[model samples]
Every structure is written in C-alpha cells, then in structure tokens.
Target: MKWQRFFLLGSVGLVSICILLSTVRNLVSINTNCPLSRVDKTTLQPTWPKNRVTSSNLSLNRDNKVHVIIFTRWKYGSTFTGEILNNNPDFTYFFEPIRREVYKNRKIHRGVFYQDLIPMLHNTLKCEFIDKNYTWWDEENKSLDCRYSKKLQNSILCEKSTIEKRDISAYLSKESRSRMVEEICRSVQHVAIKTVRVPDLKHLKSIVTDDSLNVKVIQLVRDPRGVYLSRKVTSDVCDMELSECDELKNNLNYWKDPPFWLKGRYMLLRYEDLADDPIEMVHIIYDFLGLPVPETVKSWLRINILKMSSSSKSAYSWRTKITYKTMVTVQRYCMDLLLMAGYKPVNSEKDLTNLKIPSIRKFSYPLMPNITFGVAKPNTV
Candidate 1:
C-alpha cells in the first residue's frame, strides 16, 4: 500500500513538471522565433523589421474585421488624423493607450520592454482595457498615477459630453459602463489606434502579422523642416536627432524592398498633403483601408476644415516664421529624409511662397511608388 502511494505521488510530480516545461517552451518560442530580429548593438542592425513578416505559431482568423494603427512621430498632426477615424460611427478609436508605459519605462531593456509593450498593444486592440489596471507616469512626481483613468474611459468607453446631455449616468453605473464598453468593442467592425509610442517598425510584427487580426499601418510623415518649426514655436523638445534621421532613411530604403506578402499591409501619408486637401486625403485613406466614406466622417471634416480656415491656421503657415539659419540647420539635420521623402528644401522664407504640398493620388504596389498612397488589390499575385 505504501509503494502504491509513492508511485501515485511520483506520477503527479511528473505531470506538473511536464506542464511547466510546456509553458516555458511556449514563452520562449514567442520571442525567439519572431520575425523582427533583436537589435544587434555592435552592427547597429535595427530591432524593427521593414522587410517581411515572420511566420509564427499565431493562428489566423477568417473574420474580416479590420484593425489599423496610425504609426506617427511626435507633433506630426497625428491627433488630427486620429480624429478623422474617431468621428466614424462604425470605427472605435483608441488614442495613445501605451504612451504612459513607453514614457515611464524608457530605461527598461529594449527586448523586455518590447515584449511587454507588444502584449499591451494586443490587449488594447482586443478592447481588454477595463479588465487590466494601467498607471500613467506623472512627470512632476516621477511616479505612476491613475489620473488617466477618466480619459481612458472617455476615449474608449464613452465621450462624456456626447452622452451627458442624455442623462446616461442615471441608468449606467460604473459596472454597467464596463459591460457596455465590452459589447461595443466586440460589435465594432473596425478598430483604429493612433500612437507615437512605438519605437520601431519591428515592434509591430506580432500584431500586424497575426492572422487573427486584419491589421494595417498608416505611417504619417511630415516635412522635417515643418516638424522642426512647429516644435520650435511650441517650445517642444525635438525627440528625433540627426542620427535618427539617418536611421529613418535607412529604414525607408529597406522598406523599398519589402517581401511580397507585406505589400498591401502598410502605406505612407504626408501630413502636409492631408492638410492641403483634407477631404480627398481622407477619401484615399478610406479607399486604402477598404472602408467606405461614412457620412459622419464627412460632416466632421467639413466642420473641422471650416474651423481651421476661420482660425487662420494651416499646415505650412509656420514656414514663414522659420529663420534662414534655422532652415539651414534643419536642412542639414534632415537632408536624407527630405530627399528620400521627395520634399524640396526651402533656402529662404520667399521660397515658401510658391511651395506646393505634393498631391498624392493613387499608390502602386511592389515598389511603393512615389505616388500618393497604395493598397494591395484583393486577388493580386
């Protein structure tokens, strides 16, 4: 009887060990076999991949719902772009859900940081916002705070002003609000997120390549000179340096040769062009994403354009204030990116007078032509 008891105990222990080993294997596989290779510091190879999506164990889903990330740099009119999607009744937009995480944990090791960040993004995309607790970094106290909870609630669950007039709170308690958010998340056909927190293109691999999500990326870029002028006027510190510009140029070059499978997964849009022709640009973006232009988005754009016109603010208005010295400095630092992006340099304020924001009409695939924008055709080989 004692021998039988010992054998049963040993069997239980073996089963536990096997379970632990399987879990470890799954975790290891998630990181080790990812398509985006780790950053090789010695060779300066970027941790982000602009080439191809690596095939992995992630299972793809046949559901046709679309997911989009507006991958952009700081102060590049991302808010305006995000609002375009936000106004669409059919789309659910999340604004910078990972900003606090990225800012507070800047010193964390890159690989581990990405591992945590990628999953956080996946959860956000899945509308698992309320189930998890997140703390935003308070710059003044240098501590994590839940001050953004209300903002998250408004951005994700409900816009207070929109619902307040209807006395939503009389019936919708906190618990019910969460349930409402979950149902909205599940029923929405499209999910859109705008973020500047992502450090590299490689960080997007798991989400974009996952077969379960029909993810698309819109890389928003601006004239570096315009970016510099805007930052200078607002006293905003420039996060991008000359070295980063060089890296960006190299990344663009790499993207010029992306694998065939990645052809229609992403596209580039210029903030300047979008500003010049908001309606046309939005229409093109809708076409690229395989979405029709909803009436709500049209009304929002019309109202927005009128407001901007009445206020005397335009995308290139800052160019007049940029000093020649500042122009030279900006040109020197951003020359590679300017040339690669087909932006012409302005030597003087007078040069800004006749400068035209390039109009992009249709994008062609494979080579990603200098044309405005491109999306993959459904049945293309």
Candidate 2:
C-alpha cells in the first residue's frame, strides 16, 4: 500500500507539472500585452564575421551585396519580415541601437548619443532602423498633431538641456547618408541593416546642407485605408502617418522631389504587395538590393493566406476590445489621416470587403514559384 501510494503521488506530480508547463506556454504565445515575452528566437547566437571571404583573416572584402535598409511602419509585418530575411543564412541582420534607445528613452539628442554612430554607418551590411521613430513635431505647417501625445509626458527635451544642438535633420546630411549606404552595399558582406522611422524626409532634405548623399531609397507604401484602420485599432500611428510625418509627399511624385532618393534603384515596396506574395515581392527587393535569393525564402512565399488574419481583424476590429474607448479615440485620428492620404473614410465593417491591393510578396508567384530571376546575378561587385 505504501509503494502504491508513492507511485500515485508521483503520477499526480508529473501531471501537475505538465499542466503548469502547458499554461506557461499559452501565456507566452497568446500574450501581446508583453511583447518581449512572446518573441522566441530559435536562432543561436554566433560571433559576427569580421572579414571578407577572400580578404584578410578578419575583415570582409568588397564582394558583399547591397546593405538592405528596412523602411518599415508599425504593425505591417515588419517584425516577421525582418525575421524572414534574417533567417536566410547568407544574410545578416542588425537592429538600430540608437533608435531603440530613443524609443525607450523617448528622445535623443543626435549631437551627443549618435555622434559615435554617424561615422560607423559606412562599409557595413544589413543596417536597419524603425522609420516611425525618426520624426519629431513639425511646427511650420501646423502639422504637429495629437498622434503622439502619450509620449510627451515622459520625454526629456529643451534647446539647451540636450546633447546635440544642430537642426535635427541637418545633422544627417544627404551626401553622408548616401555615402554611408553606398559604402555599406559595396563592402564585401551580405549583412542587412533596417531602420524604421518616419523622419521628416522632406525636412531632412531641406536641412541636408550637403546634396551628395548616395542614399538610394526604397519607399514602402501600405494602403492608407488599412494603415488608418490599423492605427485606429492600436491608437498609435507608425512614423509614416502624414499628420505626424513632416514633409512627407504622397504618391509616386514623392520620389521625384529634390530630396527624394531617385532611381529604379530607389525602389518602392507596398505593404500589401509584401503580404500577398512575400517571397516574390522579396525577390524583387532582393534583386533591387543586389543580393542573391535564399532557399528558405523560396519556401516561405505566399500572399493571399498571409493577409487573411490581419484582414479579418481589420474587418471586425470594432467588435473586439482591448480597450474600446482607446480604440475609438484612435479611430477618430485615423479618419483624419485617411482623408489626408486620399483614402476613403471607412467606419462600417461592410465597406472593407472591397479593397483589392496585394502585398508586394503576393505579386510574385506563390511559394517561391520557379522564376527565371533566381538565376543569380553574376558577382556584381
């Protein structure tokens, strides 16, 4: 009887542990309130390469491909998109430490904190920053609106109280920006750098005292309707929202402006296109970035299904409530943005069924469909 009771207790203990473990897993997977807790990276950390394949023992040579900069907005698959690119063994991913710090601290004087970084932007691959974080209030056009009022409470700012004192956009000169980006691509490496921010590109252009930055741009667009809808639900706008973004031009014409990074080389990726045929869309981007394609990327390509979940939520987000009032407030501002972006104002869920734009990735053949483009470009370097 003693032995049987011990065995029974052991079985119960094991079952209890299993149940506890299962609950913990659910909390990690389903909980969005805590983002970091849910971000499980399966990639093992490895020491970054310091040299080119045929160059010095530690420094990479000039055979590297284009340094990919992720100009992304919030809630538009930027995270997952970065993940897909990084997981490709040939590509390396670097997050923007300066931007991350700004995000957490709410403000950064580029004069002090970013001085060390400006010089380091050259001859590197895979550098990225969140574009939404690059903006500040633009008072000239009376465009400093209420989208980011929540952050004002904690930000530390004053003309003299800060570190960098130059005009915010003047510091990052266009010539310097272009040179750094060009050098990064020319380096004999296949690393990717992504920066997501809605800096006053127009303002940035004006203040860019130097006009010679080789900053080829890849302007990404999402449906203004969807963008506004997402902003409404989250009560937050990404860097590209016209109201919050100073000097942002609408339509393809934005690319032709003096400050605009010009070229077929200066590409445009639509968010809807990316979601629809991510692999093919990415291939076009890969080609544009001057990088070779990856096998894993070929496997992950799909468009229609990729967007179903977000589309469903966009359709019925009103019925759902993380905080109903908060969502409503966000919606009001979003409506204003929609009108500004030339999107039809949508309140009722019934109207959403008509939007037909696909993500860039969706435009490509489904599931990395066999395409002639995969014929790797000859060593362009």
**Which model scores highest in TM-score?**
1
Encode model 2's per-residue lDDT on 72-104: one tens digit a residue: 555554555565566566654544423534554
- How many residue pairs clash in all the candidates, one count each? 3, 53
For candidate 1, write residues 40-155 as lDDT tens digits. 43653223322222221011213546788888778888888887787777677777777777777889997788788777778667766565554422223223212222233343
Error of 1 at 131 (Å): 5.0
lDDT of 1: 0.61
